[model samples]
Target: MSEYHIPVLLQPSVEALVTDPNGTYADFTFGGGGHSRAIIEKLDKGRLFAFDQDQDAAEQAAKINFEGFTFIKSNFRFAKRYLKVYGVTALDGILADLGVSSHQFDEAERGFSIRFDAPLDMRMDREQPVSAADIIANYDATALHKMLGRYGEVTNAKTLAEGIVSARARKPIQTIADLLAVLEKFAPRFREYKYYAQVFQALRIEVNDEMGALRDMLHQAAELLKPGGRLVVLSYHSLEDRLVKNFINKGKFEGEVEKDIYGNDIKPFKALNRQVIEPSEEEIKMNNRARSAKMRVAVKI
Candidate 1:
């Protein structure tokens, strides 16, 4: 067992996705094959198409003994394409555990963790052109400041952006350590680490175009699922959770969970549970990264 990513809410999320007996399933983010393993175990001739952009995750998946599995080597945004290619227009359920895997953070060369001293490259798909270093070095002050504010939730986003612009101009902030050093300059000593994590998060979001990709993926999900199908989402951050919650409950990001002429809530999905399901305390203890996980399940109605 690699033990890098313990797979957050592995039981709850899998149970949500595979509740329908032998239904067609798609694990859009098959990081360690944990959920995939559970889903496959539930299937009897139930075709499951797994998607993982990371080549490492795909290679790791090949080692698993599973039936009714097909690996798609593409971003989950391309899920619609892959499903059509597989001749699966409608799926019984879709599960997405979005964001970077613990494996990516543990591998120092991947540069996803703040504890690492590696190049500032945080691309989920290595083929992507924009990288963390590129975002830090190239984004103008205003643009960088906006990213820092929105994605990182940094209090001193303006100062942080200025710091990066000034430092990169003098000598490019090319590594994770470089970014931290610059962040430490502006961030108070007590809050330095917290602030830096936010700044790095902002850069990574911009580098990966995470928001854009997420919006696209969500749209794909809404369209791909048949009426009354299941949509289960695991989001690590508020930005993602808000979108999922809004879309499922309201059927529109900004619109109120829609209402019918008679005042009944008009929605494509109805909340299966009122409260967000979190990883058990035990799971969080076993995998520290699971602390932030939130799982939500909705049924297409």
Candidate 2:
């Protein structure tokens, strides 16, 4: 499990999540099953439903021999519909660790890591038709600029986008090396790697439609969770953390909370903590990936 992906904030997340040992639960990002295994240990008569779009994760799920576990090989955006198929309308808790798994980043052929000069394919579900290369090749400069700036938070995104358009016209940007050739010219000196990371992040998010999927899952999770049920999320970046924070605090992704006739704020969930939780210093020392993790816990209202 450690080789596949070290589960960040494992103990803290599970502790906050499993309020009832005999209640139903869901692990929306069952990357390496580390969290799922811990969750299973906390269960007595309870059942756990795990979801992952990655085939490798599904393979890992197959190794779990627990009778109480069910692995759903689908994007968690469809959690509501899929859970209904198993006759589960309400949940005691839902745990989502939104970081890309270490396994995915380590796999050179997966095209997630900038260290590799592999094909530009960043699909979390390999079955997905569109790849990062396609986006670079097909998207206009405006579309590219929007994706890089909004998703990656890349500075000088417009310049980079225009550069990519000009470069791809001579030859297709089909691999990491090809993209880097164009990106290098726009990247700031001494910060080339950071620039590459930002561009790759943009491509991966677009390829996966991660933000859209997260929004769908969060809305469904609110509906699926019973009153007082927990919604625990570990987000790796600001884009995800902001959405999670807004949904829990304001009941919507953007704008102020809604009000009823009496002017009381109407929201689906209430935050459990005044501030986001971070992994222990020891955890970050052992796994650098834990450094960026921001965890938030909320209860259905």
After superposition, candidate 2 runs with Cα above 4 Å error: none
Candidate 1 runs further than 4 Å off = 259-264
Model 2 TM-score (2 dp): 0.99
lDDT of 2 by residue, 1-301 (tens): 9999999999999999999999999999999999999999999999999999999999999999988899999999999999999999999999999999999999999999988899999999999899999999999999999999999999999999999999999998999999999998999999999889889999999999999999999999999999999999999889999999999999999999999999999999999989999999999999999999999999999
- The Cα RMSD of model 1 versus the native structure comes to 1.6
Quality of model 1 by C-alpha lDDT = 0.82
The superposed Cα distance between candidate 1 and the true structure at residue 51, in angstroms, equals 0.8
Q: On residues 140-214, what C-alpha lDDT tens digit does candidate 1 reach at each position?
A: 989988998998888888887887888887888889888888877888779877777777777777777777777
Report the Cα lDDT for residue 102, model 1: 78
Q: What lDDT would each prediction earn against the true structure?
A: 0.82, 0.96
Say which candidate scores most in lDDT.
2
The CA lDDT at 124 in model 1 is 82
